[model samples]
Target: MKETGQFEVYVEVLRAVIIAVIFLFLLWSDRKNDLKSWDGWRYILNGFFFLTFATTIDITDNYPSLSKFYIIGPTVLEAILEKIVGYLLGSILLALGFFKFVPLIADYRREAEARRKAEEFSKNILSSVDEGFIIIDENYRILSANRAFLESAGVEFTEAVGKKCYAVSHHSEKPCYESGEECAVMHTFQTGKPHNVLHKHISSDGSPYYVEIKSYPFSRENGRVKSVIEVLNDVTEKRQLEEQLAHSQKLEAVGQLAGGIAHDFNNIVTAIMGYAKLIKKKNASIEEAKKYAEQILLVAEKANSLTKSLLIFSRKGTLEVMPISVNDIILGMSELFRVVVGRKIELETDLLDEDIMIMADKGQIEQILLNLISNAKDAMPKGGKIKIKTAFAKLGETFIKVHNLEPAERYALITVSDEGEGMDDETKARIFEPFFTTKPVGKGTGLGLSMVYGIVKQHKGYIKVESKKGIGSKFYIYFPETNEMPIGMDDSTDKFFSGNGEKILLAEDDNHIRRLMENCLTDYGYKVVVASNGNEAVKVFCENDDIELAVIDYIMPEKDGLEASKEIKKINPNVKILFLSGFSDNNIEREINDEIKNAELLTKPILPERLLNKVREILSKEKELTSLDSDKLH
Candidate 1:
């Protein structure tokens, strides 16, 4: 029994030692893992309880006195109590371990799910945005890109991943910063602040596009910049529209200037032309004097055409689309070109043997020649030669596409080439844009090329410019060739007629013009009734009941020509009236009443002969109508 008791004690000692060792190992392992958690402490507490129980059992069995201390209770009850205490302690320890570890596992699962949700939300937001979004790391490598970014860059996920941002965006081997371009991403990274810049990017198809880029610094938890988030917005069309609006405003400003000059200049031209005609008529018998007077009249008519061109440029004139000979126009302006370009510059023309006929406004066509020559002259300040040539061309599909013209059309090709300091690609690109000029401020209105472009388009034509820096420039204007006969080509007949003993009413604002018209009318043997303005003309017309015809200026101080004509028509429904204007027919139509009848339009500056002939024609028609009415009454 003693040996057995000693063996049992040894067994308990070994068990206690093993329990202690296991507890120590668990504690050391927990500490190694840096886990000072409540679960680890609970594990140590359970181990300690088991070790203490083992020690207590060994001590009680070894000492009979300690055993007898529990002898007060029944032996069976004592044994039961011992077992119950052991079981209850084990249960408590197990419950504590369960409580400690289970909640930790649940919390870990919840945190993992929440993190997943956050990542998904971030990806969804990035993908749904319209503007291109890209994330780049500090090494300038693409970390991630959204759908918009991928679509804009024209690359797929597999292709874009692991590529450098600069390589993907600009196809550059180095970063944009290294290439001397403004780099928003680099700026954001260096400053740890957002940056914005406008950059020109080339698309996948090698087309140049403009983009506004905004780069925001993406920071780590420790507040260090880790990456950059770039937002790219395509602004190419926006920039173009802004430029167009600015050009339109500039054209408006120039139109106002042209309109004011034209109004004042027309009166001067009318007086000059009238006096020249009067001089020719007075010196008709003397051949030498008559020749000089005829020369003066010709020059005055040319000046009148120039004033008409100013009105046309202002968009206040109508387009008179008649069949015109381009060669005749060029030849007619040769002397003027020489005078305008000076003696240092040489003017040359290569006309076709046959005239190239085109349906266009003669004055606007002249304006086009003037503008092109003027531009050429400015280019050759040090003196160079300009050559004007004409040819007939059958434009093919390729030419039509390049020139934005109708496919497979015939055009009268007018080429104006100059040997002068030419322009670069950038300048040539914007040459036809309004308010774009290389001339110094106040030297050029910048509307010359724009006007030429407008006129060409208005006449169903196209213009192309070819130029190289330090070389020369060539402008090719193409007008659709026509087969119709040219108007005003038959000028051999007499344009003058002596007016019968008939009364005429003339309304003019300028005193000199009014006097010239009065003298011209009286010299043509017509009874003249003069008025300074539209209101005065109406008064004079009502007083003279037998007035044969009324010629009225469209624009006047009080009550314009249309209003005066309306008042005159109320008095006599069959009254003959003619509307004269310094402005074009389109501009006159805007102010004139369409209801006015028995009215004809005549544009100024009208020659004295044409005016007399028109009056005679109208009177002759009125006389035939009166004779028919008298026959019907009899």
Candidate 2:
């Protein structure tokens, strides 16, 4: 009986020990799997209490009733303690669980708020953009579009939603497919890439529209494209501006090239023309020789006209500004305008006021009037009225603001209006470009308006035109007005002024020009000492005392005309000096003013007549001074 009881107790003890070891292993495994929270630990502690209760039952079972009482008493007390411990642990576990979940709830709330803010920001950005925007799906369906995009297509968003992109926006009969492959959205969908397309679209009002479509793909992680976002921009104005820029650049390049070459060529042409004129004058009886010389003169004149046009294009021509009445200029040009316009066209002049004046080069202003008149005549192939109107305009802030410039007090406004075939808007925009002519080939070089435009700009003036198809054209020329009297040339009081027996030292590089000049001066009863270069001119002028004037070429070997003039003036301060240069780059006028007090400046190719007149004028002035000195001495 004792062995039986002992064996039963040992079996129970071994079973309890095995159960406790299994529970401990389970708790360790839960902790390793990151379940070390209060719930996992509570479950583990409950299992330990259950194991202790089983061991106590097994230990007291094989003992006597009294031993059982001893086990029962502690066991009951242990059960009470275990229940209290379990209650307390259960409360702690609940608190830990609540604490661990709080941060996740706050994180979820923050994520939701951030998403709302991001959505609001996206809506604001898309709404405020000037360009149109459209979002399309991978199947070429319109998913979303902004207000601008809807307005651009002349359709509402509700009406355009879920519609095929090609049908709604492009107004295509068929769906966008791979064959044409021109649509940006379709291309992006087909190739899973971004694409651009520039095409003309028509609005609901049937008006043509220019749009640039850029489509980029929104792709999924699995290498599949989800949707295409099409960004549409209305580039009509931008394209027009770019074209204008290109045209302007082209004209500027050509004008600059022509201007650079004109200066040198004009000098060569002037020499040729001067010699031809001289030959024609000398050999008048020989009709054949005269005709040939006249032919040469004709060619030179043509060349001179070309150079003048180039000068106008480059805005390089010198301005001899003088205040002139606008009314007088219009009246003076009436007969010529009539002849040029012919009897077919009526020329009307509406001169505003006699007092309206502009400080401008008279000849250039005449040319401007001529070009405008000619253009008007050409426009009126079948007879029309051409009106020339002049008026005094106050250049207030209104006018200034239009051009982003300061206001002027007053301006002389000259308008040339013609009731003829006017230009279209496109033609009007490009009319001022050089060599851009509507006239047939060989009829015009297209430089007329360009020359006019350049001249007006160079004179600190402005010109604008208003025209319409088949109605009429009007050109407004605004020249700054000056409150001053007209400056006129002083008339000489000398009796048909001729060169006297005064000796002139003439220096010219060209032999033919030098001899002709010398002969012309000699024939006019004046002796001339000729030199091929400036050095020789200086040597001769230094050796002689009766040199009444020194006419020197500006550019020469060994010594320049300026140096020769300086040396001559050092010897005789009273000596009259004149310079002749081919181009304006030598600064002859400025140099003369700076170096010599009262030196006269001249440009070459010098005409015999002009040369003679200048020589006579200077000699007469010198003789007057000499006589005045003699009178003082007496």
lDDT by candidate, in order shown? 0.80, 0.76
Model 1 misplacement above 4 A: 1-289, 318-322, 331-354, 361-364, 382-385, 395-409, 433-435, 441-447, 487-494, 590-593, 631-634
Clashing pairs in 2: none
lDDT of 1 by residue, 1-634 (tens): 6777577657646855865685686668656855535664666477457545633542223343234445465445554555466556556666666676777788889999999999999889888887898888888888888998898888997788789998988888998878889999988888899999999877757998899999998765467789889899999999999999989986776675566456546765676666566656754557665665666666676676665655555666567688889998998888888998999999999999988889888878988999999999999999989999999888777767776664435789999999989998899999887668888755676778888987887776899899988789999999988889976655533556888778999998988788888888899899999998989999999999988789998888898888898899888877889888876655466545466756787777767877887888888998999999999999
Query: After superposing candidate 2, which stretches have Cα over 4 Å from the reference?
Result: 1-309, 342-344, 353-356, 397-410, 424-426, 481-496, 510-516, 532-548, 555-560, 563-576, 582-588, 595-597, 604-613, 616-634
Where does the lowest 10-residue lDDT sum fall in candidate 1? Answer: 58-67
Which candidate wins on TM-score? 1
For each candidate, give its TM-score against the true structure.
0.55, 0.51
Residue range 1-634, candidate 2, lDDT tens digits: 7787677567657855865685586568656756534444555455455544444543323344223533455555644554565456445544644655566578779999999999989888888887777887766788888878888678998988898877877687577554354788777777888999887766667977688889898654578677888898988788889989999978865765566456647776776767566666755567766666766766665565556656667764555578888788888889999999999999888887566877877767887999999999999999989999998877767666676432458888999999889999899999998777888755556778988988788677889999989999999999888788986655542223467688889998888888888888888888888888878998898888899899888888888888888988988888898887765543557777898877887665466667877888788888898899999999
lDDT of 1 at 81: 58
